[model samples]
Target: MPFQHPETTGHGYVIERYVTRKDSDHPRYLELNGAHVLRPGWPHAKRFARHLIDDATTITDAELEALLAYEWRSRLTAAWLIGVDRRESFRERIGDLLLASEVCYSGGGFCFALARFGTHADAEILTAYLDHYLPRTDLHYDQPDALGALLHLDARLGTHHADRITEPDGLWDEWVKGVGRLGHPSHTPAELRRWTDLHCDFINDWSRS
Candidate 1:
């Protein structure tokens, strides 16, 4: 049965109310919510996934693999939920997700969510991804959304070398602005000032062009 949000009132009220029920013994309670519903297609999957995670039910390895195949948005939500589990299964799946691509919202969210774990292996994996995939100035790097993902991961992973990543007179400035929205440490006052200065210079040069 699909889990419903707690605040929902109607035919689904039973499902909705059960979501927040504090009783862990309930047979229907799941450990991980089905985030697939709240995603673009279902719009209720997120609540389901949350309910499942909160319930503490065991998530099988096969189920985890199926989740990884979802689209970026759903995958990101799944990753965040999986990180909450703190299981070896979750860690392995998340590692796979990181290598797949540079998903903006999900990748960024996953990085931030997993940051609290602070495991050495996880850190090494994220750092390696940045080292291999982030240094180039291609469409992936130039994309503001993608840049936001990179910056979020960088902040959580404490990645340095902002100088190497920024393009002198291109969309790098805009990317920084997008990163600012993530509320990561990279958007600190000093960092913001640095980005602002670079952005101003880039805009000035653009006007002259």
Candidate 2:
């Protein structure tokens, strides 16, 4: 089933499941400048991110944007993999995607990913979603990811988000340093705010009730 953004009448993406093992976590070649040389159909999203991080300085913006269409995970992965080097491309291209998406897991992922990977300008991009959901009654049921995105963005960009976030302090504290266990801070789910390694005081009370 293809799910779309509620706000967008006909905009959405599909999560493709890989049937066979093909792409490897390690790239075929690693450049001296941390640039990862990737072939056309590499399967692993982590490998792609590793490549991006490795080649943060050398990879071209066009090359990074091109990877956005590679797969679902990679698309989001690419958003975070994008470093401060070619921020304009990420702001332009990824910003377009984020603005087009409605409030959902994918949106939150994009929200968190970009906010974490993005720079000062990203604060503007993230607050819209954060403020949008923070006021909703359903926030108790959903929106930890969005909240976390704000915290991550604030922490990273030094933006004063503490005033904007009206949610309980306990909820905000759930977002710890180092992006939690959901991989990079950008990769964390918009709905989940707990850490896998550390003991946290968060449970989906809405679900339990």
Candidate achieving the largest lDDT: 1
Candidate 1: segments with Cα more than 4 A from true spot: 1-58, 102-104, 139-209
lDDT of 1 at 181: 58
Residue 142 of candidate 2: its Cα lDDT? 23
Model 1's TM-score against the true structure:
0.44
Global lDDT of each candidate: 0.43, 0.41
Expressed as tens digits, the lDDT of each residue in 72-158 for candidate 1 is 544544554455454544665565566566454456435533443445566555555555554343324213322333444455457
Error of 2 at 85 (Å): 5.6
Which candidate should be chosen as best, given TM-score against the real structure?
A: 2
RMSD of each: 15.0, 13.1
Q: How big is the positional error of residue 39 in model 2, measured in Å on the Cα after superposition?
A: 28
Q: Count the backbone clashes (under 3 Å) in each candidate.
A: 21, 5
